[model samples]
Target: MTSRIDLTDKAKELIQELTDKHGPLMFYQAGGCCEGTQPQCFEKGGFYPRMNDAMIGLVEGYEFWIDRDLFEYWQFSHFTLDVLDGFGPGGFSLETPLGKTFKIHYRLFSEDELKDLEPVTRY
Candidate 1:
């Protein structure tokens, strides 16, 4: 099945590095003013998902989640997780101290891929 989210090689490497240092990790993507729009990387359970947040998929065994309203706005697209070399938008994400930032690049899902997309888990 097609995944709702995928990570680039750079992102995978960074995640592995972060995981090695932090033990386990998770991602939360929320859309709003401040740091909400930029995906935040946290140790597992470090950031709690709201009641309707969507568990989109996993990256290197780490759960990737998005705010319910943000997921609604992005439901028709597929997400690509990537890393940038400089500081990220907000200083709250785990990568901020490493002089790196997590970013999301998205594209609308194709007709066929949308039909058999991996299901999203909500809490």
Candidate 2:
């Protein structure tokens, strides 16, 4: 069985607002600076055909999808997503279970990348 991902209150609020304007938000991660570390975020998209054993959780009308592989890599740790003033224009920060953190910036998804995002499943 897959475990569900937890969302912070701030993340839920932001997701709700984004979903209201953009529809279902797709959450995913791809190649990054390192082998395992990569950027992750939510965006508008349709259904995805190829995805790992990820789990989606809906809370207060907000959806959260987490990569099961990545989640397992950070097992025994806690994570939180919060809005921060850094990153010049301000963006979201993902605090990992191992105390590592990454910043998410707004960007346009490439055609290939779009095909990997799983649609937000509402509960």
Best by lDDT: 1
Q: Write the per-residue lDDT of candidate 1 for residues 5-121, one digit (tens) a residue.
A: 999999999999998899899999987878858999998989999999999999998999999999999998999999999987789888899999999999999999999999999
Q: Which segments of model 1 are wrong by more than 4 Å?
A: none
Q: How close is candidate 2 to the true structure, as a TM-score?
A: 0.44
- Model 2 lDDT tens row, 41-118: 444444342355344444444333445565445433333444333232112323232233333323334456455543
Which 10-residue window of candidate 2 scores lowest in summed lDDT? 88-97
**Per-residue lDDT value at 117 in model 2:** 42
lDDT values for all models: 0.93, 0.42
TM-score of 1: 0.97
Report the C-alpha displacement of residue 51, candidate 2, in angstroms: 4.0
Residue 120 error, candidate 1, Å: 0.4
Worst 10 residues of 1 by lDDT: 29-38
